[model samples]
Target: MPWLISCSAGYQKATNTSLATTFSNAVERFQRSYAFPGITASYVLPDGTSHSAAAGWADVENGQPMTSESRMLAASIGKTFVAATMVSLAQERAIDLDAPLSTWLGQNNWFQRLPNHRSLTIRQLLSHTSGLPNHVYLPAFVETVSERWPEPGNPFTPETLVRFVLDAEALFPPGEQWAYTDTGYILIGLVIEAITGRTYYEEVNDRFLEPLGLNATSASNKRRLSGLAAGYAAADNPFDFPVKTTDENGVMFWNPALEWTGGGLISTSRDLAKWGAAIFGGQGVSEEILNTMLQSVPIGDDMPGTYYGLGISIFRSGPLSPVFGHGGWIPGYSSSLRHYAESGITIAFQVNSDRISHQSLSEIELCLARVVISSGEKTDCVP
Candidate 1:
């Protein structure tokens, strides 16, 4: 496995001049508009350059200010990393994109136990058309597991998480209707582990993170990371439910095992934008892999132009702008990454509160798009 080496501390220091003005403006607006405790916004322009800003607090209890360096959970944004890993491996011929998963993961009795298990393919898993039930909705699993391990001391092994979903039945035939399911990504993560003979963390670290020089970000197993933001029900002060080390913090449970490839990684806005620049700038993966990752597959009619490609979502309304990337909500954290290929603009925002709506993310995106389109410049992504 080719691992990406973390950047040296000196190299990790980013020059602030390029993005200082736009980032500062975004932060000021975000602070005024929302009561979020902490928020981070980052932008990557077409030239593969990035700028970022951090506002509010990472830990309101300690009065700690949010820094551009503070790492927060990427939530479902980790899906892009998982998709990249799979595509890279597929390109290497280690995993087949079209072959049945059984070719890689032998037909365990568990497959015989589930309906239409043999029909599952690698593409279906990546695009989320595998018809697998959403594992995150399994009330018993989280409650049962938390009761056993209340504190954030433990992590879920890939095998353990797969076993938990073995009993889950498919929602439809493979490549049929679209359904959002964490179970699909969980299986993908397991496949990565089995094929590489390395843990998901190790594979991602080696294959993705290191190459991008995302030294400060990582796929964390621990509940709270150093220089990391703690999730809260409210993004700002007076957090109705703050995550305590002792118990499951209402909706803010920190389960790296549960998120896995679906939503586990920890990163800062700055590193996240760097990741966009790395992948889109054709650094590690081939052009074919990048194209494959961007091709959007129809989900269902209910959501117009809403397609799942590799790890991200594609939302297209008109020729003016077609956005690519995913939006994530894990308890107190809500994040969205929108990349406009035609404009060569990427906007990434992270909020440290749970109640922040997807509509808010969409609005933020619209605001940024207007600024970019009006200025008609490849210079800055103002949000």
Candidate 2:
């Protein structure tokens, strides 16, 4: 309650309005516009005050009302955790970021078969400069998943997922061009596992979740933690074909193992906001490593002023100042985690509908940013 009160006070002092009231109104507007089953958002202001808001039903069929604490799949936001863990390991000399991944995971048959696999480095994989094909986007992989989806208990291993892109041509020579590929992260996970001789889940749990006390976050697909929000997709969209119902029960349609390191973690908005504050605020890792993670690669004109960093996206061209974070989509969930460096604010939100597009998500972020900027001290809003 104090947190909420502080947020309201902060907003009133800056904008002469109540933050909770305006935030709740914004959530309602987004819910009505997107028709999402639920939407949850949390934030940490420049002054370290925390606030959260939720709207709609976490489980539409069950009529469970959504709360700000609802846990949901965070998709590629999990990649930030992976990047942090790897960077920490690099600091420990457990692995080298620029070392060829083949040094660690070369024994695997899949690695031996992929072109330039021996030359791909950890840095390249993290930044999506490895020219690896994104298995989830490949037509054959899509067809296969479409045919086999919603099958209960059907899971895929990292090796199995990597095989989907094994024979496909590279996007470009390694480090010569930038592309986004989940397969690269899959390899990164394997390398992490190989170096530590422990499952990637274990490393992340110890390196991040435990130290940060992020009890609600999990890296595995097998743990059936309670209170997880139901996932939903568009029933009317052809792209969401063969998924007859919006229901996205894990046993029915999702195999968290398939997403693995690329897009497979579950967390609440509160936990994600905490993570954004810690990781981007330099509490989660060394300042040097955080800087490395923030370093950007030119993504070209298709995405002007946008760049992809270690595990997050950077945007510097908008009306707002430079902001960095990642967005993610699984079948029934979409999530975003962002940090406004100039304002020292972090916003983490998730909707239970993958039907929402990136552009829509950006609009939502912009809306929230405007409120935060308006609600903060004038100096905090200065670019």
On residues 90-183, what C-alpha lDDT tens digit does candidate 1 reach at each position? 8897566878888767655565544357788888889988888775666656655546544655545655556666766668888877888877
Question: How accurate locally, in lDDT, is each candidate?
Answer: 0.69, 0.78
Candidate 1's TM-score: 0.85
Candidate 1 ranges with C-alpha deviation above 4 Å: 1-19, 149-152, 234-254, 318-320, 372-383
TM-score of each: 0.85, 0.89
> What tens-digit string does per-residue lDDT give for candidate 2 at 116-149?
6768899999999998888888887777766665
Candidate 2, residue 336: Cα displacement in angstroms equals: 1.0
Instruction: Please give the lDDT score at residue 57 for candidate 2.
Output: 85
What candidate 2 gets wrong by more than 4 Å, as runs, is: 1-17, 150-152, 223-225, 236-252, 376-383
